[model samples]
Target: MSDYCRICLEEDALDNLLIPCNCKGTQKFTHKSCLHRWQETTLNNYLCCPERYDLEQVLTCRLCKTKYNSTSANFSWRLLYTSSPLLALARKHTCVLTFGISSFMCFSFWLFFPILFNVAIFSYVVFWKKGYRFKFIGTNEGIRLRIYKIGLKVNELKSGTILKATNMIRDGMFKNSKILIVKNKEEGAVGFIFNKFIDETENIRCGGPVNQSSVHVLHDNPDVEGCEKITDGIYIGGKLIPRPENTICAIIKGYSAWDSLQLDGEVRSGLWQIDNTECACLW
Candidate 1:
């Protein structure tokens, strides 16, 4: 018997035939797109169950009730595809309104300029929050596995593994570099490098290696001059920067190599919440 998609009753094509759940024989195969459509339709009204309402609800096979493996990347891609255009439209409207009102109030420029600026900044924050935000998991050793979303905890990189480092440069060359060196007795050393000056109110552009794990070093921050590891945390220059009790640092994980420069490729990685800071690993 030939395999076919159980959902659409179509012949299984290599590209579309995906075994999302652990069902057998005729019930085994379904188109990825079809599965997503079915999930959205079925789960749209059911958000009461906390366990089934998250991303797992999206990836779980409704028929077999099993989760899909290796679907995080694709799930996230689909999510961006489905949600980004709406966000872009909202952002456009916000920009037009802010600029239009500001222009109309040119007579009272001094009085309204700051207010308009604040409003514009607030709009950007809304855009960032609703669109997508990156997550970072930091450990005593270094940073680990930058994922695209919050659900895939199994694929995160383990601690003590060294990420490849490249593109070394002086911090003075870059105006907004926040650099910190991390060292652990067991994990050796790794540097947490931020290439751009983080503007809290605006969307942040994170620059670094593509796909490959690498840390860029900046030698300019007065707090990062000494580059020493204190007892429990890192020393920025001479000041001891202690680790927070239950804080998980959020990071901007860039797009996939294939999807770079496209809205479809941009996604955030890391846990949305942190309960145990001692573990340091978000997963």
Candidate 2:
């Protein structure tokens, strides 16, 4: 197939032609010299009356509407000569090249602010001779450390210890529960909701969801044989061989249990409050 130059419109000298843009068919071929001269003319027109033409039109093709390839077509200085004038034009109209003043200011600020920040940081260290001390917060995790220090920690949980649910457990079944620790150890822990009474049984309490089907008992009477004391006034897993004269007892269906370390995690996460030291009432 014979190639024709879009610029010179000649059939001969096809070997000197280069395809530079997305233009197809006959318009695809362009001579290196011819293309450079055409770009120079378009750039001159922009320089003469920039309002009459856009710089993009100088660097791009009108037909294909694509930016002209700037790579050296043939190892000639023609590309260098063509770009020198364009760079001069860019310098002459520096404000216009940036699209306006506000845009230029924004670009400048973002480009230099990070550098200025690093310089200021280094200056502070050099002036004070503190070397490098990067302390975002203290070792105890700042706010959390302050908060948990005022309460009983998860590691402090033990048998008969009382834990009240915080407002953070708003959507769960354990919300607003005052739990009395029944069995607590490394194996796991079991507690019952002391404040939630069951509707089905007159005095039986609803423990919680973890071991929902299991039943346990808590009582204040040591007279009941086989009763094991849990805390100051609490007992578990005993029989009423001889009921005491004054006994406070509850049969709880279901119990709340945690796997090893699970209860500790919950307590630390602010789900339960141990800081409350008021002589609290228990169901």
Q: What TM-score against the true fold does each predicted structure earn? A: 0.24, 0.43
Candidate 1 per-residue lDDT, tens place, 1-283, comes to 4569887898955565877778898898878777767766545644445345443455566567776666622566356446756755765699887888888788588788899999988876775555433446565568875433122222212222222222342233222333222332222223333443333333232433343243222222334434543223322233224623342233433311211211122211211111123223211
Q: Which clashing pairs does model 1 show?
A: 136-251, 147-269, 223-236, 223-237
Candidate 2 residues 232-282, lDDT tens each?
A: 777887766465668876788888876565577678778887743521565
**Native-to-model Cα distance after best TM-score fit, residue 113 in candidate 1, in Å:** 5.9
Model 2 TM-score?
Answer: 0.43
Every candidate's lDDT: 0.44, 0.72
Best by lDDT: 2
The reply for model 1, stretches above 4 Å from the true place, is: 13-16, 46-55, 71-73, 77-283
lDDT of 2 at 186: 76
Error of 1 at 262 (Å): 47
